[model samples]
Target: MVKEALGFNILRAKVVTFKYQTVENMSVVKEKIIQEIESIQDEEMLNNIHHVLQNIYSKKSIIILNDEQKVKIAQAEKDYLEGRFYTTDTLFEEIING
Candidate 1:
């Protein structure tokens, strides 16, 4: 029983640490975004960023995505940044029309 309790405590500590690390990672990303926004000078680029943020904030419901979906979205963004994504026109022409 004591060994079982010790195992439970270790699991709980791991969960707590995971949650803390998630929040810390988000805070780091938020700080980086703020720093980049402060350094941005182009009006059009800022406006585009503002529009995207507004769209994000305008969501009416709290949509809870599962871990797999989150991982897929992160991977998609990484692929996009690495120039491994398809263009809208190409997608429309090939997948949408064909």
Candidate 2:
């Protein structure tokens, strides 16, 4: 199996090769990285890696809502504040009886 992370193609196998480095096992890569990190004393390099990892793992995105969507969301919030929502049982009963 192969997985793509960022732009790197990760091969899930006993032996994986990337560029000039040969990793013995994909499962041990994390351990190897941890060991390397533990031995590294360079603050600048570690900080760079920290920032890179943050960007790679971050899931935040900006969602631009249109006027109609904004209005709908505002109406929904108002309805919820005024106790205008239906209970699950009532909604199911109405659906079944209809």
Candidate 3:
């Protein structure tokens, strides 16, 4: 537990997480950001932030992909469940010796 100090005594803890947002709250968030940016006196700093944001926004989102065919993948999964899959060193030895 996360304890905080009260008068030389440990108090209660609180937890926070980021899963609260849904699709309906976009406009309120945008309005607050716009108000914050307008309140900023340095337009140059805002433009720099905008440039970096655009670069990050425009990049392709990353995804990890498995190269195995679906049938082979399923078979390998079954082998794993049945304790029959190979280790990395065994696979390397097979490749080197074969």
Candidate 4:
């Protein structure tokens, strides 16, 4: 029933132990997602996705990414996890230099 109604092959309805009594919960979830999408739009998420796609399809763009790019991103994530991330000073400098 859910698959037919929602047209999503990747998702399934989680069996609820207690039934939702009102539309309020569903509406709140929808509104929250809308708000988050709006925030992402303002933060230029679309531009970043577009940039990634352009790079992916353009012959001039990298067809094969180097290990350095992968390592750099992984290290950044690791640093963030360890709470050892660079200050805005370093970030700004890197952005400016790049």
Candidate 5:
């Protein structure tokens, strides 16, 4: 039913589609980036990329706990799973009453 006849054909119908590319995981993306970096021959660009990476890594802080701390954390987790930990309301009540 074409009233104004803008560009419609009642007898013919067509459908169009486009396919997009996708990456499966971080490993594939990381490998692609590494391959691109290896292909670059510009010394200045490589130095700039290296400096940026160094700065990014330097800003991160890592915590290394001793064995005793690890054991305490594991025990706390076990206590939680075994219903040995107190609820937030209970702790808050004790804090306020004390």
Candidate 6:
């Protein structure tokens, strides 16, 4: 029983480690992609990449807002047009000071 428990614990540890490593690997991949994008000088290649990214983004499921959410969004838009919104910097300053 002791040996079996030890084996199970080892397997669980491996699974946990694998999950963490996958997340870390994804971060590394994202960083590499950013670096590659920054280093690319070809405008055509950049445009192609942008087009592919846009297509990927466009395929995502569209959000269907409820009536309450739609009303809130409309109010927010009205406020924006009336210049009732704080700048991001001002918002962050208020948050930090508070």
C-alpha lDDT values of all predictions: 0.89, 0.75, 0.67, 0.70, 0.74, 0.92
Q: What is the lDDT of residue 4 in candidate 6?
A: 100
Candidate 6 stretches with Cα past 4 Å from truth are 60-98
Off by over 4 Å in 2: 1-58
lDDT of 1 by residue, 1-98 (tens): 99999999999999999999999999999999999999999997897787777778987644556689999999999999999988889998998679
Question: Model 5: per-residue lDDT, tens digit, 7-92?
Answer: 45432232221111233456679999999999999998898788778767897644556689999999999999999989999999
lDDT of 1 at 19: 100
Ranking the candidates on lDDT from highest down gives: 6, 1, 2, 5, 4, 3
Q: Please, what are the lDDT tens digits per residue for candidate 6 over residues 46-92?
A: 98788778767897645556689999999999999999999999999
How do all the candidates rank in terms of TM-score, highest first? 1, 6, 2, 5, 3, 4
Compose the digit string of candidate 4's lDDT tens values, residues 1-98.
98676855433333231234346677898899778667774456666656777888887764444689889889989999999978899999999999
Q: Which residue pairs show backbone clashes in model 1?
A: none
- Stretches of model 3 off by over 4 angstroms after superposition: 1-21, 60-98
Candidate 3 versus truth, CA RMSD in Å, comes to 16.3
Q: After superposition, how far is residue 51 of candidate 3 from its true place, in Å?
A: 1.2
Best by TM-score: 1
Backbone clashes, each candidate: 0, 0, 0, 0, 0, 0
Once model 6 is optimally superposed onto the true structure by TM-score, how far is the C-alpha of residue 8 displaced, in angstroms? 1.6
Model with the higher TM-score, candidate 3 or 4: 3
Model 4 vs truth, CA RMSD: 18.1
Every model's TM-score: 0.58, 0.37, 0.33, 0.25, 0.36, 0.52
- Angstrom error of the Cα, residue 20, model 3: value is 13
Q: What RMSD does model 5 have?
A: 13.3
Better of 1 and 2 by lDDT: 1
Worst window of 10 by summed lDDT in candidate 2: 6-15
